[model samples]
Target: MQHLMLVPVLLPLLVAALMMLLGEERHRLKMALNVGSCAALLAVSCLLLLRASHDGAPQAVGVYLPGNWQAPFGIVLALDRLCALMLVLTSLVALAAALFACARWHRVGVHFHVLFQLQLMGLAGAFLTADLFNLFVFFEVTLAASYGLLLHGSGRARVLSGMHYIAINLAASALLLIGVSMLYGITGTLNMADLAQHIPTLRASDRGLLHAAAGILATAFLIKAAVWPLNFWLVPAYSAATAPVAALFALMTKLGVYSILRLWSLLFGDEAGASAQFGSLWLIGAGMLTMAFGAIGMMGSQRLGHLAGYAALLSSGTVLAVAGFGQNLLTAAMLYYLPASTLAISALFLLGDVMDRWRSPVDGADPYEPTSEAAPFLNARLEPTRGFNLDEEEQALVGRPIPAATAFVGLAFLLCTLMLSGLPPLPGFVGKFAMLNALFNPLGLAASAGAQPGLTGWVFVLVLIASGFLALTALVRAGIAHFWTAQGRGPLRVGLAEGVPIGALLLSCVLLTVAAGPALRYAQATADALHAPSGYVQSILGAEPVPSVAAGSTLDETAEATP
Candidate 1:
């Protein structure tokens, strides 16, 4: 029963390895395997979620110790409501991405299926690992896979932006190593649960060292999360990537947020003496600045991909700011917002790709292909293909009515816009409303009188409302400029495979809106579990009999223990 925890991680590893063994021409077979693996992953993730949240246990959390070794020594994988929710979300988006990529993206680059699966593996491992070292390992794995995916099409722009992406993350990785090593040296254990137990007992003299370690670690995560000053690389890097890859990359920033929530709640939540709520003010302040910057960027963006990039930053900032509040209700709301925003943004990335196709003038040549001798360098920016001509003669011609397919695409774009901007009648609005209600309700901190969030809460409220307005204004302008006022030389050619994924994603948003009650309740439960870590720690270090390992510890400990 406990072994089910390993499937999400191992299944992707197996699929990626098998795909690597196949020839490039075996595209159909590779896709078949990819789809099958994703289906299996979704199934297993659902089972894990159900098991973790089962009514009978109420306190149910699964901890799998690799090699039957005890905690603080061996690799451990812990499954709880939060982990399960993340797994299920990752698999769903992955399935959608796979289906969408089938149209042409999978073939655009070599080893797409392998890298995709590897990326999934890395995401799952990051969510499941119960220690700092493995967290760093999984972070590297995900980033390595993402580097390949970002450069999948290998155009000059892609390569250039990919180089910047690589250098930035490499620096982040070094910081992560330093932070993890510092913690391990102090705690005598890399296991997260053990670290939590040890943090409160550290001497006052060593507290400064711990803070330094945490600050370094958070700098790395903030970079990945695209928080303000450190987030300069995100827009170009994401905007330059191919559509499917960008869609998958939507969750990359969320991973950073997850790490923040997980570590902060576990290690610093009312447990660590002087370190409780450490750096939270910084989180809130930085998050607000990020949102402000994202809003301005969204308004000024020239391309749909860049607009989507700014939208992502806005979403990340909102969640980060709310998370900084440290209230259970705010955390619950953030959980709900996490999935809602992730799905909406991912759909936007996919939908943005199609919309770009519609607006762009047809060009026979690949815009992304490397052309210059210096294309391999880190700072090159290739010229993009020109779309519609705006010359007076071209504009003077009578415009054709929007085609039926084009109208449908526009409708899809509108829906995506509504969701991303938190417009009414969409899940985005609901998530934000829930968050605000949590912040300002009578039972809430600021509204209860004498709470610290008095001014801060209102600032958050104003920023949230203002960001949505900016999104609406920007999206409306883009929609009108592209779809209402202009027409391409020919009708946009959209196929069934291409349209299905977009429709499905939009439909899911609608369903999320309709079912907001149940969704919010589940998110609340997940947050409840997160804020109280005793149950999780007990599951990992206090309870249960160790399983028997079939073989002696002769192989690589982590690899052999994984299953």
Candidate 2:
């Protein structure tokens, strides 16, 4: 049982290494290993998720005492509900992306599986590690893997853009090191479980310094997340990368948001009220601006790649806004938006690739003069009379059609739109309903009470409504043209491998919609547990939060209860 936790982290690293041995020369071996590894990873993470939901406790795996040390001195890789759940989602998405990349496996070659496995290991390690230094180590591992993937199909654009991506993250690495070093210097500990208790005890001056370190650390996170002003690099980096690579980048933004939420739960609980008053306001404002910027960019865009890229930016805004808003809704939003946005963006990217491959001519003529009209796979070529040419009337009636594969890609974009726009019957709409429930009701306004938002909920309501309205308009305009209008171009047959992953994604969305009630209950449980993180400290370090009152002012007297 103790070692069950290691399965998610170890399996990918092992499989990736195994794949490296197989190499690209044996195509079947590479495919088998990739598919098997991901399947195993997904299965393990799901088991972990089940354990978390049932047990409702951090699963401990004291894997190695290395010199038989225990407590903070010994390393720990714990699986709690939040981390385990994230692992499940991460593995699922990574598996889908890996499977999708199979079509172009030959093009990607030897480096493909190596980088893919490393990326998953990094993500798993990040979620599991209890040590701060270990977090940095895993972060770099992830980055290194990502760098290779980014430049897998190298071109001038990827080369130049990948350089910027590396350089910026390197700078972030330095900052993270500094913050962790300062934190260790002050607390004399590197374990996250230990720091939670020690952080509130530092001298006022040290607290200020800690906050500064947090800010610097947040810079790295924000930069990665593509939050507003720092997001200048995201569009180019994401748009230029291959479809699967772009799909992985979709989750990177969430990493930053997750870290922030994790840190803030420790730093800014009701004990300080500091996290809420100052932190929430700042992020809420930034999120609003980011949503505006992304919306405007999407509205002005023409290319499918750029459109999807900007759409990623818009999803990042939702993360910030939800985090800033706080309460049960934050987790709920994360749950809904993550899968929704990933499917949406990924589907669109795959479609874009298809469009570029089979684009019809724009000169009012049929480029596919001889082609399989109804059954593409049945023939290599058709008679000149068999295919088609689009005249003016026909063109107008069908409207502009993307290439065969690209048309289906629109489903991903539609999913993304539903997520961003909070359309009905989708998980995003459920998330929106839950958020508004918390916002207006505040203090568990549902059949149950939620945390009191105080005045922040009011601010959140206004901001969300305003940005949401614009996003709605933008998406409606963007999608109506593609989905509602006729596709004048002839339909092309899609292969099973390509269609299956997307079908799975859509199927997942449907399940999420149908199961939203239970999901919300789970999120509420998650929120309740997170909001009171004493269990985390106790479970990991066998310690708990002990309040210390200021000499002159009693905490209760100074306190503003958020509930």
Q: Give lDDT tens digits, candidate 2, residues 1-563.
A: 55677777788888887877774687777777877888888888888777777874433222322223454887767666778767877787777777777877335535687788888888888888777888889888988988888887888898888988888888878988888888788789988768877776667777777777777777777777778898887778878888777777777776776777666665566544333333666677777678778877877775667777887777777677766655655655565556566666666666655554434423444434434553432233333454444354332212233665556666655665676667787886777776776566544544332245667666766666666566677666756665556355545445566666666666677787888777766666666666666776667776223344563357666565535
- Show model 1 residue runs off by greater than 4 Å: 55-59, 362-404, 446-451, 545-563
Candidate 2 Cα lDDT to native: 0.69
- The whole-model lDDT of each prediction reads 0.83, 0.69
lDDT of 2 at 457: 62
lDDT tens readout by residue for model 1, 1-563: 68999999999999999889999999999988987898799899989988877745444578887666788778889998899989988987888788888889899889999999999999999999998999999999999999999999899999999999999999999999998899888878889999888988999999999999899999999999999999999999999998878888988999998899899888887666677788878888888989989998999986888988999999999988887877778877788878877887877788788878867787454332334753433113322332333333433112234566777788888887888888888888888888888876745654321225668888988998999999989989888887777754345777776777777777878888898888888888887777677778878897444544643354458686888
- Model 2, clash count? 3
